[model samples]
Target: MKRKILAAVFLTVTATSAFTGTDLILAAEKTEETAVQKPDMEGIDTENTKIGISIYQFEDTFMTLYRTELVRYLTEELGFKEENILIEDGKNDQDRQTEQVEGFIEDQADVMILNLVHASAAPQITELCSEEGIPVVYINRQPDSLEMERWEQEGIQAAYIGADARQSGIFQGEEIAVTENQGDINGDGEVSYIMIQGEPENIDTQYRTAYSVKALEEAGVETRELLAQTGDWSQSQGQKIMEEALDEFGNDIEVVFCNNDAMALGALEAIREADRTVGEDIYLTGVDALEEAVQSVVDGEFTGTVFNDYFSQSYGAAELAVKFLKGEETEPVTLIDYIKVTQENAEEILELVNS
Candidate 1:
């Protein structure tokens, strides 16, 4: 993992109004005398607010689905003007995301929703938005420790909305352990697992891998980290990494736990090249219950996956942005729940995704 450096001198503000939510913590800075307070809006006009949605990248199919759903809901359901919503793809580049954020600030966007590439990079953006009095909402990623400290100091009206990444990992790990223990399709009583991680600095990868390992340990499964490599959420990178894992571990691998479905597909190709049947010779699991992954489950090529409700996360961010623009009180953090998808529930999961 790459080491991230924190920024210095974030904009500081003080909160005068009291709020409560598990998703965020509110604190006031001593220097500021007066702070703007917004009332929670159960009903208000949301006709002309401009929102900017900045994503880390658009490379993965699952992310594309998320983006599509967000745009659809914002336009069709929320009645946000098509031109009012700005969508920027960072292409997985931190520098690009920074530039895009600065541009959004210059455009004077009503609210900015971010899925940051690096947690530390948030302080600068947050500081800028704070100075401009624009609320920033984070989705799918949380601010790093330093950023969180600065957030409280700045009295930033922000929310961290996304699935519990560590819990998602634990769910994936538990499913794998249970299946292996039961020897449902015949197992050797021992499981050797490989993890295809996401971006190196991504919080999701860290938490998910940690909890997944803990779950496996608790289950008494002899798990080995056969290959731990950064996929960077690129299918090409996933394919390359899985190819190397295949060359090294080959048939001894009992389970392959991928961070997302695209990489899971890539790993599937590598398994095919080795002439081993997936879900038979070796089971597979992934996060981001993407279309292809769910389809693979229905076809018996993979075992299970975790579903982070991207639609609800995006929708909640948009709703919060509208409220914030209207000077309404909003939580600093809002966490969305995740679901585990297995072959038994693949059809239902697919229906939800499609709907």
Candidate 2:
């Protein structure tokens, strides 16, 4: 088992690590005032305004929190009627989600907040909604950039509200790179990692899988992939993948990067079962800064996780829907910043998540 030698050096690097090659466009900062105040709905009929929300999967820990907050904000804060807001779970099936969206269209929903089951289906979904003149606010799962470009070029009434997946990936890599040995636990001159990703077709999975390694490389650390597998954002799948990776790679696996915390928690179980202690022999990083994951970081079980900022994201989505309803202009793309969570800030984040 190997441990980081200089904790101070690691802390310094973690604090100073910055995003490279892209300007941070934070919608949270832009909507700070609106997030607190209710959207002005002078002539808008709150009780009669029908809202349709379709989550990719209700089982997703992060989106579960997001949908809850989104509904709460729309009703309690924005004065919309609870009965008018209809939410459906897509069950991670694209065809099922398409049917649900069609139903929303048939019901003549005033606005739809969509967490797409397949982001690649954006064009089809957009066409269905646009033909009916239903404004859409897409949340969480981001569509392809080209689709967003079409939204702008054609002046479509759609907007995407989510954090940049690249930032989350960068944070994950920075967490491992800031380790005293840059996650080269066995002094092998390379960080050998197992990547536990979410759905393969999801943009989050793609960006996180690629940019995590990109961040390590940018930090001047050599990296080798011991194994990579999709957990489909399921904890059990994460555990099974980690277990198999451990069996094959053993001590050579210096780090495990999970696209989200549910998988990281599952991976942690696998690591413990193998009697391999994290932050000693191997380090782990994940995204979404889930409550349990944050507590794990505080307890020194995880290297770090990124705060997905569901509060800002959900609120932003709702705000955009309100904007569309009011015939106000909205940017086609809205981005929130993902915050890095480590021992230094884990307790604070845990409290935030709990609240």
Candidate 3:
């Protein structure tokens, strides 16, 4: 008999729900079903099942840490053989990623986990995987609208697991609002700020910026749009933009809200070149609690940041794939929770990541 897979929306549940009774035994812990059901692993033929992961790029520290932890947990912790996992890097190219997915399909991979470089390119991959009866799980980025609608209709084995970019932005903005800026020139209770955005087409950029603007407005912070440039999630690009902003706004710029940690680091470089001290002369905020970002927070370089928990994301996606393969039910959209990381909690976060 063919396995019957299920899909349901349960936003309040956690990632631990992806295992089954057998999985619990293997995991050596009885996880609560109220959090989220674990993917059924019975009769899965683990030795034969193949899983493919397509990521944007492994150059970034965040992606590297996640990939390392995921491989470790999935192979060592979950008892899957290392050879069964195939990882492909897109080199930040959408076409290349699509081709990689095609190759995975041709190889008859049982499941494909994709972190799309371009959301619009997702449909072709989804359609190809669907035609071959292979499950597709989207992570970190939102797929295009039409593709999402079709995936729902086709009952595809898919789940979205990532941070709510908008909410993360709101949190960043709230941090900036309360940050005292002694560098303000006029001392009129207003501060100048610059935004370093991620890739132009990235959905996170739009949502994060929008929610940040909302929070800034609510806090009555007068922000000058000195520089709103796309960093392409590149540290070098961030450095260039920050340099330009420094040349334009000088010490008048009190805050820098970067879309990710790399850009924030770039901004830090620019600030350093200008002889401005971070955390003392100006406040810096960024998303993606990369190890460097956490370290920076502990070192007093940044004010704070939001943690996307990439390890949890990978484990959750793996669990979801197992569940889909087992004919178990899951939600179409599974957004993971995010945590705020500040100096006060940096040690705890560092411990978690290190652990």
TM-score of each: 0.83, 0.90, 0.86
Candidate achieving the largest lDDT: 2
Mind giving the per-residue lDDT tens digits that candidate 1 earns over 28-63?
222134332222444644465678888888865776
Instruction: Write down the worst ten-residue block by lDDT for model 1.
Output: 1-10
Candidate with the larger lDDT of 1 and 2: 2
**C-alpha lDDT score of every prediction, in listed order:** 0.70, 0.85, 0.74
Question: Which candidate comes out best when scored by TM-score?
Answer: 2
Give lDDT tens digits, candidate 3, residues 1-355: 0000111122233533433212322232233232333455677878878888888888866777767766765676566678988889988888898889988888878988888878777777777888898888888888766666676777876766665677778878877766664324446676677889988788899987777767877887666666688997788989999999889888777778899989998888988899988777788889888778888889988888877667567777777778777877777777665666777677666655565
Model 1: how far is 168 from its true place, Å? 1.1
Clashing pairs in 1: 23-333, 24-333, 39-328, 39-329, 159-332
Q: Report lDDT (Cα) of residue 187, candidate 1.
A: 54
| lDDT, model 3, position 6 | 12
Query: CA shift at 73, candidate 2, in angstroms?
Result: 0.7
lDDT of 3 at 229: 85
